[model samples]
Target chain A: MKISARNKLDGEIEAVDLGAVMASIKIKVEDPGVLTALITKESAEGLGLKKGDKVSAIIKSTEIIVGKE
Target chain B: MKISARNKLDGEIEAVDLGAVMASIKIKVEDPGVLTALITKESAEGLGLKKGDKVSAIIKSTEIIVGKE
Candidate 1:
């Protein structure tokens, strides 16, 4: 899919926790970190996401506040 | 700052484009991908964010739809 957002991290599925209305997906990207995504239960099932699957964390937000200290 | 979101990509500021009310911040992660963040101009200035500065791309969404094929 063509997305305007430029960040695309290559990672593997680490965990999948599905709730009634929401689901949390943990993607283990390189650099020794994990990217967690929260989505709807329906969407999670639709994607057939599971542990050891490869997926991209598609993040498109207009409120990505930048910080410096 | 304490956020519920678990995805925090550590990166360095690659670019900062400021407009009247909004600003676009680009961050280069270690995995050879760039993360783009769109925030308010006020927030951008308030954080004193600029190129070469290190910041985390904080993504917290309740609708991070996952896709697989």
Candidate 2:
């Protein structure tokens, strides 16, 4: 299925750390190294996310912050 | 300020499209092709963003989604 989010990074799961409410996922991508994603524990479990699984990190343009330094 | 967001892509502003309520910013990064950011029109005006300006795209892990196909 097609998604609206512009940033779709394909990578393999490096690790998964589940917390009480949230779950942290580490994805290893070739272009940008490691990308971290945090989602609800329920959502994580629903997707059956695990280490070494191939997945894509999807981010919308609105969620991204433009920082000037 | 040190942000907890792990994905920070430093890039130059390529374009800016301002709407009545929101604004779309296009940033060109070296590693990735281009990153798009959507922010409120007020925030865009407050930041005085313009083309050729150097900036970083900041995104929190929670705002990202993981998809498998």
Candidate 3:
């Protein structure tokens, strides 16, 4: 399905760490190097994510913050 | 100051479209081509954002989602 979120990065899953409520997954992308995603444990299990699994980190424009250097 | 968000993309503000409540800002980055950020009108004005302004698009890891093809 198509999404409205502007950012969608494809990469291989480097690691997955699940906690009581949240799960931390690391994805290694070519352009931005690596991106870390903190998602719900239920969502992680629902997606059947594992090491070496190819996935995309999806982010919405509304969730992004603009910062000045 | 530093933030916990893992994704911090440096870019230049290409344009800013402010509405009554929300604002849509376009940022041109080197790696990801161009990114669109939906920020509040208050934040857009508070930061004094304008076209050609150098800025960074910051995103929290928790706000990211994992999508598989």
Candidate 4:
């Protein structure tokens, strides 16, 4: 997955796998209602991400929190 | 604030305030570490956002979780 960067706040990126190393890199932000992540454990060990390794998911935009679920 | 939409998962938007009444519009998702928002509630009453109203904050990228402070 790739996106390098975006606007309004922050959305930078870098991702590589298949033994390419450089496995984790991400940043996306928008905090109004609540939505924040600042990950960096060597990119979770270059994407080795233990405990589970099924990545990719995103949310931003004033931390969307609509009412009356 | 506006962004419309983005990819890699989901990032949609539509924010307008200034008595224009069209305030809420957001969608950001990245559920690996936990950063998911789907706000609506008429855009939190068109940005009037009671209970406090100071917008803008963002965090995505596998829900960013790093250890070893």
lDDT on C-alpha atoms for all candidate structures: 0.77, 0.87, 0.87, 0.36
- Global fold similarity of model 3 (TM-score): 0.84
Instruction: Report the poorest 10 consecutive residues by lDDT, candidate 3 chain B.
Output: B1-10
Give the C-alpha miss distance for residue B60 in model 2, angstroms. 1.4
Query: Chain B TM-score of all predictions, in order?
Result: 0.87, 0.87, 0.87, 0.21
Pairs of residues at least 3 apart in sequence or in different chains that clash in candidate 1: none
How do all models score by TM-score? 0.88, 0.83, 0.84, 0.25
Angstrom error of the Cα, residue B36, model 3: value is: 1.6
- Residue A39 miss distance in model 1 (angstroms): 1.4
Give candidate 3 regions above 4 Å deviation.
none
- Expressed as tens digits, the lDDT of each residue in B1-69 for candidate 1 is 676765677889999999999888998878847878999888889888899999988777553545455
Q: Interface Cα RMSD for all candidates?
A: 2.1, 1.9, 1.6, 11.3
With a 3 Å backbone cut-off (N, CA, C), the pairs that clash in candidate 3 are none
As for TM-score, the candidate ahead, 1 or 3, is: 1
lDDT per residue for candidate 3 within B1-69, as digits (tens), equals: 777875877789999999999999999876557888999999999999999999988889988889998
- Give the clash count for model 1: 0
Clashing pairs for predicted structure model 2, backbone only: none
Indicate which candidate wins on TM-score: 1
* Candidate 2: segments with Cα more than 4 A from true spot: none
Off by over 4 Å in 1: B61-63
Residue lDDT tens for model 3, A1-69: 687785776789999999999999999876667788999999899999999999988888889899986
lDDT of 1: 0.77
Question: Residue by residue across B1-69, what tens digits does model 4's lDDT show?
Answer: 434322233333333332343343333323322222335556556545443223332344443342211
